[model samples]
Target: MDLSRPRGSLWREFFLVASLLACGIRQASGQIFITQILGIKGYSTILAVDNVPEDVQEYSWYRGANDSAGNMIISYKLPSTQQPGPMYTGRERVNREGDLVIRPTALNDTGNYTVRVVASNETHRATGWLEVVELGSNPSLSVNATSLVENMDSVAANCHTNATNITWYVNYGPISGSDRMRISPDGKTLVILRIRRSERTLQCAIESFPDIFQRSEVISLTVSYGPDYVLLRSNPYAFNGIMKAEIGSQVEMECVAYSLPALKYHWIHNGSLLNISDATMNLSSLAWEQMGSYRCIVENPVTQLTFYEDIRIQAPRILSVVHREFSILEPTVVLLIVWIVAAGVYLCGVLIHALINRYSNRTNRAT
Candidate 1:
């Protein structure tokens, strides 16, 4: 330890010691002061404190409040014993390196963040701000009935909001072919050609821009009178089942016939054609002898269809009491004449009694 060495040597050694002490103090100060940094809310980011001293104890972070009126209200606290505001809470190890990192940043993570460093002798702080944003949600779509009709040419329609475009398809059945129908350029309607009544079933589809195949609705149609022939047979030429009536009983029998074309009706009884001057042939009153098999013949010239109904009447049931009462009228006349003669005799007796009384009163007066 040559205390008295050359002056230059002493000076150079002293300067080197002083420089080393200063560097040590500077490092200590840097470690005491912690810094924090933040970025947008949705972005992944980091917290930086590059000027940390060599002996940093830890860090404290502060989350901002959600209120609009408040200015970065504290939400959490770190180093519970310190009990800073509830929001001023974050903890991490900060060493001389002064480098810090946070991964997988969240939207809530956006706010004012601070770093608190504690060295053996002092404490320091640094802060940074962060921003956040949210992405838009997926859109929705809807459609009318899923199918379409050709000859009716009615189309399936769709509705949606915030949509860019749409498309349609024929999904099922023999109408699976798409080329038969054409969609309008504006995606409004579909046109089909040479559509027969049988080809009424069709399927339609729709979509929106940016969305793949969203959903679908259906439609149905009926076509009128196609060439496909329908052969209608006559209603089996049914008779009115054979109606039976008693003579003298008023009978009204209707013979009805039906065909695509109109029909002419003729009435016949007992093998003789009934001259029907009117639609209803009136016999005025029917007699027992006139009872026989009655028929109505219906013929349609256009349809070449013929029909008939048969009706029969049984002979009248005559009462014997009515016949006996009619036969007694002659005897009733004879009894009536006898009662008249008895009344004339009683009238002559009354006249004789009156004349005798008158004669007796006159003779008594004269004597």
Candidate 2:
């Protein structure tokens, strides 16, 4: 192709090919210079020279200085196709605009490049640098929202970097295409339609050749759920879901639920709301009327969820009441039993002394 003309021009008005007129040529009349290019690693990029004469006959691209024959990459004469020079590599091709295109550029490609343009009267040369970047730093991860309601809200995540190979993971497991997820073509942006509690952690990584793996910082999302798993109990004693306490004793009853953002607790007794409105219910000087079924309501305000649970707060009933009464009288009854036993031992001692005296007197009188 005639590389001297503009990109849209089809006519072979001029040509710049490899294998330059192996001679030292000064910078021609025009202020022509190679346009500097920043190329991405593992991607296609181009290098071109600007302000060239329209009547050019040939073009040559060189690796570095055009001082020797071995430095020429490619050159072409008028009416001739591009031919490789001694330094030509198979990875480059010149476009119609005399721009050198490199496919799959690399880090070693970051260096100076020179282009020589030929016209009917003179030859011109220009030099510029190409910088191919392979990012060594960690990628950045971002999310649209950090907090969401489970199964009702969504989140969008983005990984920002110039990396070509992007992989995403949720909770340390690789993620693939799914109905609730969306991934951009460049693997930069991701969206989840519905957020769940199980997917709290997310990450993106650049996977390159030769064991080059760079991971982004973790993106954490909070999924709100629950108000279930309700439990009701007291500190001293609770058996079979029933809170046990004694009369005239102060007791505490606690209600709890498993939920995010905490839960609001409400106590209930006799099918009516009690004044106690926290996770704890305190009762003192309990009587028979105070012993009955007690209930509590748990709610998650964020999730708009409510859970109900009931427990019996029985002080003592039937045999349990008898046992309680016996425990109260135990010390007094033990003291009375001790006094009676002591009195009985003293009476037995007196009776033995009297019998011994009577027997001795009878023996003496007989003697």
Question: Number of the top candidate by lDDT?
Answer: 2
User: Which pairs clash inside model 2?
Assistant: 16-58, 16-59, 17-75, 17-76, 18-74, 18-75, 18-76, 19-75
TM-score per prediction, in order, is: 0.22, 0.45
Candidate 2 runs further than 4 Å off? 1-139, 161-164, 179-186, 235-245, 319-367
lDDT measured at residue 39 in model 2 versus the true structure, 0 to 100? 63
Question: Can you write out model 2's per-residue Cα lDDT over 158-257, one digit (the tens) per residue?
Answer: 9999986888889988797689988888999888887887888989988643234678999888899887588777765778867777777787788877
lDDT of 1: 0.45
* Best candidate, TM-score: 2
Candidate 1 lDDT, 205-312, residue by residue in tens:
344212223333444444333222222111112234443445455555555443433456687889998776223444445677667676767664543446665666
- Where is model 2 poorest over a 10-residue stretch in terms of lDDT? 12-21
Q: Report lDDT (Cα) of residue 46, candidate 1.
A: 38
Instruction: Assess each prediction's global lDDT (C-alpha) against the native.
Output: 0.45, 0.75
